[model samples]
Target: MDVRPAAEADHASILAIVAPILAAGETYAIDRDLDETAVHEYWFGPTHEVFVAVSDGAILGTYYLMANQRGGGAHVANCGYMTSSSALGKGVARAMCLDSLDRARQRGYRAMQFNHVVSTNTRAVKLWQSLGFEIVGTLPKAFNHPVHGYVDSYVMFRAL
Candidate 1:
């Protein structure tokens, strides 16, 4: 798989993957009613370093990396990842995350943090753990999952 910075041409494909996930209200904490323009801005806004994972000319996943906080916290990084529904279990998210780590180090980040990982997303939780992230904290009943009602969320971190 090839992981590269996203371009305008990748917008539609990015939405194809992001929209459903947002609509499902499963993992991400974004608004479910976001229109295309808002979604585009959120994904490609100035604050993020967006990337896409492609294989055979098709986008398999996308992710965005940014500062976890400003000023005193700029040394740490935060990221959000989304894999195409059809690409699950094919290692696309893994490759993007591995690439993000390298890119984060290159950008001088001291650590990486995931602020709100839904506990019900076990695949992602396990994957992050296997990639060396630690669950530093858990927020009780943080995410309102569509099917599962209220669920806990975790704060995952890893030193770069």
Candidate 2:
């Protein structure tokens, strides 16, 4: 598989992967009924940088990275990752994550932080831990998981 910076031509596939993930309301805080235009603005917008993993000309996963905050906080980066349902367990997310970290360091970020990671998403939590990210804080009932009622959200971080 090849991992490269995303272009406008990849937006459709990016949306295809992101739509269901957001609509499922099980992970990200995105609106359940988010429109295509808004999704485009959020995922492929000018403010952030996005990358995709492709194999055999099909995009299997994607990730976006951007400054977590402005001014003094900009040195720390934030990221979001998504993989096609059919692509799970194939190391797509892991590859994308490693790429993000390398990119963050190359861009001069001192650290990376995930502000809200749903506790029930054990796979992601474990993956982050394995990659050296620590659970810095847990906010009680920070995420209202659709199937699991209220669940704690973790703030995960790792220094570059």
- Model number with the top TM-score: 1
Q: Rate the local accuracy (lDDT) of all candidates.
A: 0.95, 0.94
**lDDT tens digits by residue: candidate 2, 1-160:** 8889998899899999998898899999778888888888888766689999999999999999999999999999999999999999999999999999999999999999999999999999999999999999999998989999999999999999
* 63 Cα displacement, candidate 1 (Å): 0.4
Candidate 2 regions exceeding 4 Å error are none
What is the Cα-based lDDT of residue 80 in candidate 2? 95
Instruction: Give the lDDT of residue 159 in candidate 1.
Output: 100
Q: For candidate 1, what's the RMSD?
A: 0.6
lDDT of 1 by residue, 1-119 (tens): 99999988999999999888887889999899898888888888889999999999999999999999999999999999999989999999999999999999999999999999999
- Among these predicted structures, which one has the highest lDDT? 1
